[model samples]
Target: MADASGLELVEQALGHRFSDRTLLEQGLTHASAEAGYSYERLEFLGDRVLGLVVAGLLLARFPDEDEGEIGRRFSALVQADTLSEIGGQLGLADHVRAASGVVNDSILADVVEALIAAIFEDAGMDVAAEFVRRHWELRIDAVTAPPQDPKTALQEWSQARARGLPSYHDIGREGPDHAPRFTVEVHVDGAEPVQATGASKRAAERDAAAIMLSMLDPESHG
Candidate 1:
């Protein structure tokens, strides 16, 4: 296969190689990077599968919690950042077969879901669910902290204690139209700035501000 190396890398990172090689191949294919049969389709399937699995898990784990709590936790677990972080952790970047010039992590998010979808298709939902449980359950279970919108949090912090409103700038953009990645810089009124990247301009800006806040509150950032 053309992407044999990529396939091997995937198996290495995943700790299990696919019995049906084509499934793994499909998982590694991003529409922007590949000609056809991309991970987009798998991502769609995985999105639904993820929702089902998470909902079931949340119900079992948080028996006393209400619907709103489960929904929030599910949203947090399936968020883009969480997926991207999992992709990075699994070293998906090293194995992902994308088109030239598509270096952004946007594809990373879809690829994670696509891989899950592939696993579900190849082995079955039971197999895929267990894999997800091993990798995601603990993180999903530990919901001790309140979620804050990083951009809003930063803005309010600046307004309350800092000199003025925080400023954000689109520093750079990369990749094609379908999946352009943005780099954003956030500057506080009178403080040093922070920069980060995301799939959308808003996401990048929020991440940059979040990074800045983490610097300000290291103890709470975790």
Candidate 2:
């Protein structure tokens, strides 16, 4: 059993009290702990729960957006980086149980989802949804505009389609090292590859991604 006060600290962080203490423990237990019940299953369910709740939030917040624009924002909210940022805000790493007693961004992200599932299991969907809304709503508000950087926009679009991130290939570079121009191609599944050239590799990638985004929909990236 977990210490009484320890669980309370976590409860305070999560902003919800758990009736089933075991569920709370399971949510914090890493797979390496071999504790019979790890957070993996909870993480899986929490991922979906989060998506459903976040989708609702996006619809209410951005009713004027097309599916493509909304999907980019949705991808940002549910991505591992955002989840880990949320976990860090909740101070979740200090509460997790694992062999190393340390957690990475991926583990922290999974733990956030697991705790959402734990909340859903312990109380109900209302409380779980409230938790997501309370945290994620602020995130949406903080961003005055959804991401618009070309490469970032393209990557978000790819992830939104469940096609993973776009891959960038460097075709070639020319001119002197100090003034070399590079050509890059951006490729995503189910989409034709697009290429562009720029003063640097990163610039070329950005241009290629922009070209690809334009081909998909001239105004979809806004």
Candidate 3:
């Protein structure tokens, strides 16, 4: 409803009521908005909270899965893409207070974590875990098997073709120190070099390798 407040809609989407309204407000405030408070700190705490809950969910859901398999599933579930997708489904972007025209996967992902932290702070781990389960259950169920790590897959592909190992180089860095962006170039013998940007060098390398892998074998990547 257009008449409904942003916080109200967010609370509805999250299926939780906030005792301290300030937490919800802070969670929705972006760093660029110049709001005296922002979501960064909450996002940091929520990241760890999300990880622990997701790990517990995986262990309970797949008792037979070994640590490696569970770890892969956990990584996929907590990736920025996944979090942003979930945020979109919950209409979180509509409520985020950011500078005009500022929107990205990182922002959306950060706010989602911030909200989770707020919930955890308000109602403790049980409520926070339940909220995660409610929103993430379908995704967890839809995954038939743990997806292969893109970097590892790319390395195996290069080795199979006798290309030795792919090399990664940091080509550029930008943005603020707190939230820096890194651009990495990945080079493999006999193939055109590919580059990608991410919040960190490791993430950039993974992205570049994934792109290169997709280019080299579209069907496999798909």
Choose the strongest candidate by TM-score: 3
RMSD of each: 4.6, 10.6, 3.4
Error of 3 at 25 (Å): 0.8
lDDT of 2: 0.85
Q: Model 1 scores what on Cα lDDT?
A: 0.79
Q: Candidate 2 lDDT, tens digit per residue, 1-222?
A: 567788899999999988888999999988777678789899999999999999999989998988888887888799776898899999998888877666766678889999999999999999999999999998988887776668887888878878889999989987543235689988988888888986667668877998898887653444
What stretches of model 3 exceed 4 Å from their correct place? Answer: 1-4, 173-182, 197-203, 218-222
lDDT of each: 0.79, 0.85, 0.87
- Residue clash pairs of candidate 1: 33-98, 33-99
Of the pair 1 and 2, which is ahead by lDDT?
2
Lowest lDDT sum, 10 consecutive residues, model 1, at 97-106
* Location of the lowest summed lDDT over 10 successive residues in candidate 3: 1-10
**Residue lDDT tens for model 1, 149-174:** 77777887778774588988878998
The segments of candidate 1 whose C-alpha lies over 4 angstroms from its true place after superposition are: 151-175, 182-197, 208-222
TM-scores of the candidates in the order shown: 0.72, 0.69, 0.87
